[model samples]
Target chain A: MTDPSSASLSSAETDDGAEAWVDPERVSLKNVLLPLLTFSVLLLIWEAAVWQARIPAWLLPAPTVIGEAFADWWRELLTHSLVTLYETLAGFALSIALGVPLAVAVVYSPVLQKTIYPILLALQSVPKVAIAPLLALWIGFGAMPKIIVVFLVCFFPIVVSTATGLTAVPPALMDLIRSLSASPYQTFVKARFPTAMPHIFVGLKIAITFAVIGAVIGEFVGSESGLGYLILVSSSQSRTPLAFAALVVLTLMSIVLYYAVEYIERLMVPWATKT
Target chain B: MLASSSLEVVTTAGSIDRPKAGARAVTKIQIFDLYKTYATRTGRTTALQKVDLDIRENEFIALVGPSGCGKSTLLKLITALIKPSRGKILLGGTLLDKPSREVGIVFQQPVLMPWRGVLDNVLLPAEILGLDMTEAKARARELLELVGLGGFEDRYPGELSGGMQQRAAICRGLVHNPSVLLMDEPFAALDAMTREDLGFELLRIWERHRKTVVFVTHNISEAILLSDRVVAMSPRPGRIEKVIDIVLPRPRTLDMQFSPEFKAHSDEIRALIRRT
Candidate 1:
């Protein structure tokens, strides 16, 4: 006697009334203004400390001296900075390309997971920096060594976080999909992968920071170009202010990459429940 | 048995007296000699034992039992989500070997994909079913409207209230137009008022579609109110203890809940549930 189809159909209607998605406005002047003001205040304090304390310039150059050095070598440092950025981005992209598919493969196949996981853990345990010299010798001094080092630093977190996310689906959630009689492939595409996005972003964010570090490390041990090379040159010549400027630029590059990743995470996973 | 013609006349009269529809079809679901056991590092533990049941088509049956009673496991078995250690499940006179598109499931949590909007979550099954996306989206909109969640089509699951989220989940389950809806305490996370509202809404929908539903719930009152038959279960090597039939009239209302018949059914089911 019941019209089961209509009942289910209208119950679907009941849900349609509650959804409310809105476009959040983008970052505005107020956002940039606050941070800029804070940075200025910090700079002013550093300058005042140097002027008042009369600290030896060799040990800790004044803000004015660092600023002058930054201006003096702006063109040269910018070129090197761009090279490092290019290496970092390429390495990060490569890590994502390799890591995500590998994570998926591991999640879907237990045999592959069992054989590969322990090996990965052991590989991660080996200090990557210690292997940098050998890698340089093998690959030579072109971009390859630096890119490989960056890839090494950035790949693990992506794979680990992505794998965790894929596997960490709650049992109840799986039940919801299972009862639907969803095919294994359907379940993965519709439920498991989407659920893993936020976790993947976490891994990517961490890896990006380390990617920059890896590129710098590659330059530190053996490289003809990059901010790292500039650091070596400035430090050896006892141009501490120039070294300080290079260091500042390195920190700024890392921060920019970190924030860029964070921004992408926000865009890609706005509905992240944990956040 | 009543004479066929006379039975038809009687049913017609009974239906006229009622305000809503009745079962649209009879779906036979049989669980014969079902057994599930697990061998942990500690030892062997049985989850279900000698469970036998025959569910007639279009019956809204509620399974109520203690934790670890294998109620969820039973649902899993029927849906072919897991292989029974030894047993058989028959739907419409055919053995259930794999998960079928004829069944829709709503789990305890909303479990809506956080990255998908409300409408997209509801359309998930359609996507999986390889159904037409445009048609599915249109149907999804209608289903959302039925649940009183209209105009919320674009919102993410995180933006919805608990009750609202569950409502969206229910829409997702029913969207694929499956013949059977399996709910594992789908409203358990909701507040009392929301639970009551959803219970009635679910009944209204069931009345319209008459799909066979097997609901798992811990709430005695909920089981009594929603089910045509309440299957009471016992824990550890879980067994079906009793099956109590509700003979109350159709289009059951909140007022009937206060009537003697409703209370008697509730009390009897509660007593049976506590016996274990």
Candidate 2:
């Protein structure tokens, strides 16, 4: 507990104010190149394995065949990707429109916290996949149903993370503000909300990833235009490469959406996220 | 509480910039027969009992005791963050029933928001207090410079060492120009050298700002070093055992801690605490 040598070492190691770790935001070429290199290597390996095995495209398409499907079906692929993107964005917007206010209401009112929070937990536990079919039956096969699924998937995490962030203020800071005789509004604006920003971003990132899966789930249950629908129709027709291409689009969509959230977090909560 | 021999040091020891000691100062705070009880799982438990003290304007007092001795509770009570079961506090001749604007607080932790830069962290109190931002920014910058965190204003708390963050916290506590600065073991989390350095830095800040400083600490020597009087408290229905008037020279330093009179006061406090 009282090691003088180690204490001196720790004192010596302190940078005063400089961070010791590698900056997360630092954009080194090696960082970009390493991931790109690995992905290319993996794709090349896949191409070699499929060619050596003489595997049918219907069984498992090689990367090149999938690329060909992309080239051939570019127009249809763009149309489906746009449909999916619209649903994802619409649902995500709806989630933010509702989820953030719901979080604030729940955090402020104990009655709402006790009542609404439990209901949310109960509803959330019933899988979104299970609920998608019911939603489709009730709402019919439209973008509305797909967007609703995305909304359901995205809303809970936003509410939870926002509520947690709103309440997660350090007790000491609470005391400091209290001692200042700060009004409740001042307390929230100055202390509570900023504290919650980082946590809200945490929930937002989680919900963004979930939003894509939700849209896909909705399409799988019953839809005609989204990437999920393309995958279903293509697979049924034994056009495995087309299905694989749809998957590649969905993967890219998820990555782009996640990075969008990450970028916004950097802008909005720079102090929390910046190295 | 002071030995007669050190009366000379007590009066003339302050920096020439600060006012001379030994003149009777106006009473800044009056605690009257205070008692606090908590509703425990087993039943009601008394946290503090029969506490009574007078804090003079611009006087630096330290509350020193072991853990669970209710020193922290007393600070909260003084801030009016919590209420006493019986009796009351008068802050600047006003009844202290709610969180008072007359006092600022420095908690054990720096508690700086990681989302805010050091300047903005110090500016929080001013913003919450609804002071003029233009003036507050000026005062905040001045405080940061005074605390030797001059140029690191834009850095986040994560970038600073524990000592630096605590220094920024001290600036935050003073930015609103509150008459009373209630510190609850503010440097306890810091290393020994940093803690000592901060204690002296605090004295420097206090000498200029002239707040009625109520500093709480478990460290006996720290209490004796920085304070004009050290309030020794005891546990199990915590109450003050003695108020040892340090009577040490103004603008206290770490070197004073090893002096014979400082050791005498330290040993006196240790013996009082051990008696419980």
Candidate 3:
């Protein structure tokens, strides 16, 4: 009785297993090698064009000049990078602290959802860059304004993603928990929160990238130190290579932070990755 | 010249005999005058009407019917997942108005938390009920082992096959050791072969644990195989049509399915459902 079905299922599973075995190796090889190769080729072309065209350093710095500038001011660049990173991390952390609870409240209470969701949407629609100068006037040219701008920029995605995650729990799973006579709090912790982790991480990833941009915007408007401030100072001084170096550092920081979030996501919800 | 003779005919041919072992069985769940009506945007629709049933302790009963017969609704009502609209459900002689820890349930889908491993999924009920963690963990392990998933404790639900996942779900339902276990077509999603395998697996588990089970299914042979009595219901204002006692001996094997007695019972139930 078991033979026919078991045989069919086993054959199907073996086929899947064989396909899965080959996929990861090919994907990893392509993911790492292709990006590196593309970046190297692009950099070589940029360097060759600068040499061939004999472009002035002030107009467009070559890759070699940018590298030289990065090496010369490595200490300064590191300090400014640290400042920006701090702002991004702090703002991201604060958003998670405040936004998740707000989302939970919105999800659980219809009255709150009705009253608060529209206001949040309206606030989010207003461009945060337009308010940075006003924030600088209020908080002065310090890290606080940058932090506030980062917080403002990143808060909406967290709230939206968390709320979506909480609401997206399967009805059957909810029924299972409810059937257990679980309290509302128990239901949220055990069923809703865990189920929402993947969605929440998605929001976090998007918000992290935006946070770096927000911090930079804050610095551009008014700040004495930071990668954005460095870029502003270098450009005003006509040190184009230094500005390029600062931009590279900022891009690298953003990439590193995004990947860190993704790494934590994989750790927190390994089951999500498999499917 | 005798006047025209009058005669009365009596036959016990189709009369349902309550399983002999049930003579001393205590009533565990008393469902009285149950009525359910759903108010949709269109209007009120009656889901179930004036249903009455008494379930004996440790008796495995199957509610068999066509789709839309409110069989799943009945399971929901028992678990207090939904209100009956008009009747009383008494568990152990006490009126049940809300979900109680004294009952456990399994749905058509396994519904195992994808985030949880097999053992953790089984311990979910215990954790919710605030039971002893050490004891519950030990029981979870044992239950997993009982379902032939002993070494799979660390595997996530996604890692398991559909049948294995459902088995884990069943283990979760029984983890708390509730007096009654309710299943809503738990094996309906499986292929025929897996369905049969799970049916026998369920029987094995029931034999060992002996909890009062009210299983809902549309499969006639499945009902006959696993249940002590099969309650047939009609659709559109779902109501009980008839109850048939399965007098087959204990520890039933798959080979017994081909016997003449089994065929007779299957034919009888099929005919009854066909008429509905």
Candidate 4:
């Protein structure tokens, strides 16, 4: 008991120390001001360096120019951002919808896991970027191909994490449940699934971060309208500022989606984030 | 290893209050020549052999041994979490091949789900057993109160101290009101002070609502202090070495441990363990 308790500190009290508890989610001015200040300083340095050097606009646009382009192409940016967001959301949703159930199967069925795991790992090895063109070629340049690429990138992590969480139920907890004569399904619903929630959210968060990148890659391969397409067309046409604006929008989308998952995690599994 | 075709499993040390022949009716758990062996890479390791014991209804029996002793294996066997390699365990005279709802267990760790609140954690067994939620919740509240965790129902396991968490775990073990409560060194993880406090708390809880308890601990004083009888076992091929009935008065006080009788019991147990 002594050594085992010391060993499983990760599962033990990693967080709840004697230090007074701070609500992790509450937004404070000190938290926002530091990042905001750093961002402003970086942007100022870039803007000043660009102005002093008189760098060619096509080579690198100043923050002001990017901001101007952002304002000038507001309508276009909004349309493209919405399209990219749709693909990202759709692809991520698909991954989660398919991935979680697949994880449960992998955890429960050894035969299924043995058969499918190697194939999954192999597919993971083939770069999502490499798969994008093939996906586009097969599906013929639409939201479907981009969504599939997004799905591909998001799929592996979700399944891996979900499976890990599902299988990593504390042995003592399993014993306790076993002592109750809980049916497999009952054990799953009552114990395994809830135990896996924090872990599942970890996968979901990682997959969500990849979701936008996947959509952009799909658009880069071949697409009509999206931030990826906008960046591609604008940069090829020497609309550097416009492309930068699109890139910025994509980044914002990624951050927003990541936070959305985190917010959901905080809401659903409040006990998990206590650390 | 000595060759012995016939083995005497039960060893009653000093004076024992032998129950009448009709006492079989009160026997909640009957272990008959129970053996457990684990097939390891080297060879088959016998964890327990020819262990016979009868735990009476509401009797508090503590199984004490050093590390590698099969006290834990015995507890699991009684819970039917793992089947004995040989012999049999009968719970209330029925052959216990699989774990039933009648057995409740608390491990060394709290094992409370971090995600669940204290109330929900306590009510888990009730939920699993398909008991009435309302009644179970009522009983759960009562139990938490019994353990002095009355106002902490909404708190998560992480927010509680180690002793508090174990107290909640005890509440959980007793929530379903199981006939047999198997605790495997439940207080061994806490600091010495918290361990003692929780030991008293457990005795208080056990006294009010009695259940057949088989408490396993390496702590000699703890086993002696909490149990009605201390079943001391040896290591390696784990078998009962001696069973000493604690004749200490009810509502056992800490001062009783300093008494000559307690010292005599501890010395005898210490000697038996050291002889190996």
- TM-score-best of 1 and 4: 4
Superposition TM-score, candidate 1 onto the true structure: 0.86
Show pairs that collide, candidate 4: none
Alpha-carbon RMSD of each model: 6.6, 5.1, 5.1, 4.7
DockQ of each: 0.33, 0.41, 0.47, 0.45
Taking chain B only, the TM-score of every model is 0.89, 0.92, 0.90, 0.92
Clashes of each: 34, 0, 0, 0
List the global CA lDDT of all models: 0.82, 0.87, 0.86, 0.86
What lDDT does candidate 2 reach at residue B67?
A: 91
lDDT of 2 by residue, A90-208 (tens): 99999989999999999899999999998999888989999999999999999999999999999999999999999999999898888887888888888889899999999989999
The second chain of candidate 3 has a TM-score of 0.90
Q: Per-residue lDDT of A27-101 in model 1, one digit per residue for the tens?
A: 456677889999999999988998899887777898899989989989988989998898889888999999999
Worst 10 residues of 1 chain A by lDDT: A19-28
B1-276 per-residue lDDT for model 1 (tens digits)? 112322233233322322335634343687777899988999988998877776756778898987887898888888898888998999878899988888889988888878888998899888878898988888888888877888789887776777788889999988888888899888899888778888988988887776889999988888877877778877876877777677677766767788788899888767765675
Question: What would the TM-score be for candidate 2 when compared with the true structure?
Answer: 0.90
Model 4 lDDT per residue over B119-198, tens place: 99999999988999999999999998887788889888877778788989999999998888999999889889778878
User: Candidate 4: misplaced stretches above 4 Å?
Assistant: A1-31, B1-25
In terms of lDDT, the poorest run of 10 residues in model 4 chain B is B1-10
